[model samples]
Target: MNEQKPIKVILVLGLFSFLSALSGSSTSLAIPKIALSLEISSGLATWVLQSGLITTTIFLVAFGHMGDLLSKNFIFFSGGIAFTIGSAITGIAPTFSLIIIGRIIQAFGSSMIMANSMGIVSDYFPDKKRAQALSYISMFISAGSISGPAAGGFIMSVSSWRWIYLINVPLMIAVLIFGHHALPIPKVSIKQLKSATQGANWMGQGLFTAGIIIFFLSGAIFQSRSNWLIGLITLVVGGALTIYSFYQDDVANLPWISPKILHNRPYLVSIMALLLVMLVNSVSNILLPFYFQSYGLMTPFQSGLLIMLQSLVMLVLSPFAGYLADRVNRQLMTIIGLVILTVSQIGYLLYPAGMNLTRIIIPIVINGIGMAFFLSPNNALTMGLVDKSLTGIAGSLNSFSRTIGMTIGISFGSSILFALLPNVDQITPALGETFLSAFRGVFYVAIAISSLASIMVFVRYLRAKKTA
Candidate 1:
């Protein structure tokens, strides 16, 4: 590949990656407005957010396999078109139903992108430069996420929520045209493509998709105390379907959910580690805005700004982290980063109700540094340890794990916080201590979960090092 080709390739990938993050983050700020505009229940508005995540995640494995066996670039391009079209539909839709249809289409396209982007990068960059290149994805995603809310708010102030969805059309069109020339088109035999298509375990995929949706739906249901019984039943049924899906897959040829992935210890550990950290991080993200506004006496903008601090640090540090990931022992780097993250979590756990602004900033800074260090190297480990053919699947699974983590975190964090308060509508001055109790409970659970993840990595590899 020519030097310019690598640069062009990153530009194409980065644009789409940024677009995906922007859609997610920007839409969050617009959800209330959408609900108000449509005169819909908050419940229905939430579906707008959720449909995308569920669709994107469930489709990842299937699309990932396709990217590996058929063509990553093709799948990636098709996804872009789908996303753009979905954007147009949502932008113009008169009814909420149409908006949801648009979201589902967008999710379909997003799954395609998530499944293949890492595989494309792995193909384009040499091993020495791969992690650094991957870090650029992290940076673009962070930029999109941080800018999304601010941008969305600005658009809504002057224009309307529809503009947020509409804006991507021109940008995505530009990326599609650029990517046509930039993304490498790999050559695969017709025989390989045929096998990939014919050998796909359709039954297994359907069951898996059903199970994932039901399970996630159950979690969403649990947000309501009145629906706990239904949620429990749904959760049980979903778990059974997911387990059975895997059980059936064990005997299937060329299974979408491969047994090979489960057997790879390093890859398995890296995935687990990634999931755990995301779960931990997401809890803070979901719970903190409430804390900042309610207990910290901060305005909405101030709350957002405080949270943005972590993303800012991550944006700056990710590239450097990626650079070091290429040169260092990645496992060791992840472990150290986890250690720093543990320290930050501890800081949060111990901090009093007052949450002295200066002291809290220290932990937030540490969390950012820790995440930057852990994420890039760990991302490298996941795709790097797998074979070239499995790279796409590995990347999809990685994205899958992160999405699952975030989803569960939101569910669990909200459930735990509200469960303690029972009927409390607002965090009043009279109930400060009770709110603090629920708040600290989340961090306690988070720290415990993260420690288990750390030990999983540290002990498994410690044993390996000794044996070697």
Candidate 2:
């Protein structure tokens, strides 16, 4: 611990965190292009998205387990290598099948990185410094996600979408080489390792992984509303598996994630708030570009340019929010954030059809500020609430909440969307008013969801007050 500084570890982890986000978001913009180039169907290209998320969600806890039982940086380093190799493979792959394989590998690597990020950060930084450092991770991730479309667009303009995947390799290699020596490793005893390994609920883990993937596949990619029988059957099966896995883990002599985490009121509430917010947030992410295009306010690329405003706001405010979090009530900031988010949703709801840029930027900027304030403080508070030994599992589950929120958010949002505008194919000019009505309808749902999140945060806040 003495040999190297905590900042180095944070810097390296932060960079990798940035890269992982970049890899996912950047690739998203390339999906249609990739499908076109490979001469594959859109349905097949959907798998390109699903594969990475499925693999990431599946391996999160397992890799989190490794973070604790093995080494945090070791997991981090290995993940970086896996991501780089996967990126290289995808960059050059001649076949769609090969690209899917590469995506899985890349996403698996992302799981490893995400599952351990908080654990590594926790290991290095003390309480006073931890929140601020955690803020750094959020900033980088925001920067990467916001920049992704632009990066992909630019790459495709000059070279190819393949270059976007390849972009990850060089930076990753440098991080790996430098971090090979610089990152700190928490010392683990032989006894500790043996105990954690023995206590692992392998059966529960298997069921959980399989259940989530199948469930996600059923509910999100192919829903019962669309595919009726197939979706319904798989959803039921997956739900059952997931429930049984938890039940099994509950009675097991040893649970992979500490049962205490579930029982922790502050942690659970805070984590739920984070998840709920992300859930609504993802709606905006998916809907906005298309909405802008429909309104003739901007092209998809131009809307992306406007959205850079939100990301810029997040990147700017997060550190400042974190600094305030350490000084004041974290939950207060959280509540403020959620409130602002609801306002933003209202902004979207009241968004006039064919509105000017001023109208557009207001809601976008508000949403960004809300997100920046909420995420880091909530993370710092959640991590703070957990025991040191459970940080790996806690962190992974934390990451899981964000991942799952993002994963299902689009589904939740789009389901309502399609329900509202079932007959409408595209938001054409003739149907623009109808589509705008439906769009406002979706934001109404977003507002309701945002309210639910706000209540959760309030509950958590009240509990903290009572305790204090």
Candidate 3:
């Protein structure tokens, strides 16, 4: 067996992983510009962002199963190629529809990479080192999360929105080259590979993806129509598909998320906690930018800068949080993080509409730090709850939970804002007030969810102690 240094491999893999995540957040800062340039409605333009997320959400599980069946290196490299191609297409696209298409392709590539990145790390590192390695991965994600928006804004200010997509090509090429040289090859007998490939739950995957797509599409369509019959039909169809998907998973021997992991108390709790975190995180992200631009009377550039503070705080704190999870009680760390998040949400709710940037900056930073504290440690705890052999499945399920949460949060938050606004056609002072009120409501909901997650983690900790 080769004793190739794991850290070096992780560092290389981590850089590519960071870029993969970076592509997701970078487009957020360019939304207004893209909307204006494309002459698309803001709601429609949102699909440019949501398209990637929806694609990623659908494919995460399927890719995870593929990772387990195929070589991780093959999957990773293929994803890199797809991402690069998609970026090139997006960077030069003259039409908005083409851009959405590229985004979907990019999302597909991202799912492939994300589904297996942690699994690869787990395969390479021992348990003692795994948390630290995962910590590094989280740090990269934090860096991407913070930098992507800022970079997108800066590029858009100086050039065009297309540059945001253009920037990925060189980065991806470098990753592809380095990955080819550095990634270790997996050795398996042909019979083993065949069995693994054939064993995948293809029917479950199809049903799950079909259910998610139908549900989202139906909701999007139903939003514009006032016809109750049409709305009811869409709703019923979507509901049926979702129910059927889950029924197949539970009843059949093959399931999208392994029944074994889903049934575990710790694993289920971790999924719930992660879901809440993502919901809060995505809602806050959407609300903060809109709040600053509309209510705080800040320009898009200024709002982007202010948003960067949260990402910056995350970048600084995530590694420490990861290390702490290894040395201290992870459950305690999660609860503490949730507490800080709750405080941050309360701060946002209570902030005066006319407050200066300085007054609110502290709370924003605090919120970011809270996220940093939770994300890495929570991820570690979740994966740690399962056996090493199940890392791919666990990682995919975790990503899926976060994606679903983000989708629901963004959709629900936007719906509330639009419903509350008296005049949806124009941005006015009263509209701003309505939006803020909706944001306040959303934040309150976030606090409740975070609290529930904290309680779940606490209960899991007590159970673990009792068992021990």
Candidate 4:
């Protein structure tokens, strides 16, 4: 397995991960600018981001299936090129609809990259060193998150928001050119080859994609509380379709989830842990920015700096976490990380309103440290349990879990925040208490979720220990 080191493969994967992360975080920063330029409401402008996320959610598993059947290099190369084209479209779009179309295209490409990168890494690296390679993947993701807001702000200050999308083109081209010679060709199993020849189950693909889109659409619409009938219909239909698709696949003796992955208890628990973490993190990501800027009265740049602090901590600790994952018990690392994350959420919930930067930084920094400890090791553990042939679906499932969690977090958290403080458009002395109350309610829920994740990890660790 280790005839040639996979330095280049890891590099290419890291860059792709970086691009995806960068675009997500930066887009949030550009939302206001985009709204202003398009003469659209801020709420409407969010579609630019949501469209991409929704497209990614719909296509992740499909692309992962393709990764199992297609040449990994080809998938990787095509994803980069497609992302470049999508970015270019967004850069010069004359209308918001076009921008959204561009985003959907970009996300389709991102799905291909995000879906396959980890599987490709798992293929080339031996188990002993795989965690270290995965850590680099986590590191670039953190770097992208850390850089996005600052980069977006800088671009907005000097140029147009269009530059943010445009920026990805050059970076993607670099990856495409370099990755051609760099990424190793995957060794396909006979089963995979057969599946490749037969091609994917297009009907199953459509059902799953439609289900996901419907679910997200319902959630988005429900958040506004303006269209209950449509949302209810969507929720019912989507749930039914999703279940039917899963049943159909299982009955047919083939499924995107494959019985191996679906039956692995450790992998399942690990996914649960990862999902909870992303859910809470995404909630915090949405809330803290508003809290800092609206309540704390910080400048947008200043708030970006505060928001970046957590990712910065995550970036610094990811490699060290990787080193420990290789040497230490991965389950132990996960439990500790979850504990820290739960505690950090508690810290945020209890932190007093009108606190200065120092107090805000402490809890966020702790959250970052917890994330740093959790993600890479947990990822390694998840991938370690799956068969090599199933890694494509496995990687995609992991990314999809993250997407689902983030969607839930943002949708639910934003709903609660607005419901609590519907009139809170500005920071005033009298409205401060109301805002704090809403913030506390949202984060208290986040704490519950994080704590639940911690408990899940603890139980898994104990089970493994007992079995050992």
| TM-score to true structure, per model | 0.95, 0.93, 0.89, 0.92
Every model: Cα RMSD to truth: 2.0, 2.6, 3.1, 2.9
Q: After superposition, which runs of candidate 4 have C-alpha atoms over 4 Å from their true positions? A: 1-4, 185-199, 227-244, 422-429
Any runs in candidate 3 off by more than 4 Å, and if so which?
1-4, 32-42, 94-97, 158-160, 186-200, 218-240, 422-427, 430-436
- Backbone collisions counted per model: 0, 0, 0, 0
lDDT of 3 at 429: 51
- Could you tell me which residue pairs clash in candidate 3? none
Q: What lDDT does candidate 4 reach at residue 255?
A: 64
Q: State the number of backbone clashes in model 2.
A: 0
Q: Which candidate number maximizes lDDT?
A: 1
Question: Candidate 1 has which clashing residue pairs, if any?
Answer: none
Please give the lDDT score for candidate 1.
Answer: 0.87
Give the Cα lDDT of each candidate.
0.87, 0.83, 0.77, 0.84
Per-residue lDDT tens digits for candidate 4, residues 281-347, read 9888888877877777777777777878888898889999988998999989998999899888987
Between candidates 2 and 4, which one is better according to lDDT?
4
Residue-level lDDT of model 1, residues 153-184, one tens digit each, is: 89999999999999989989998988888875
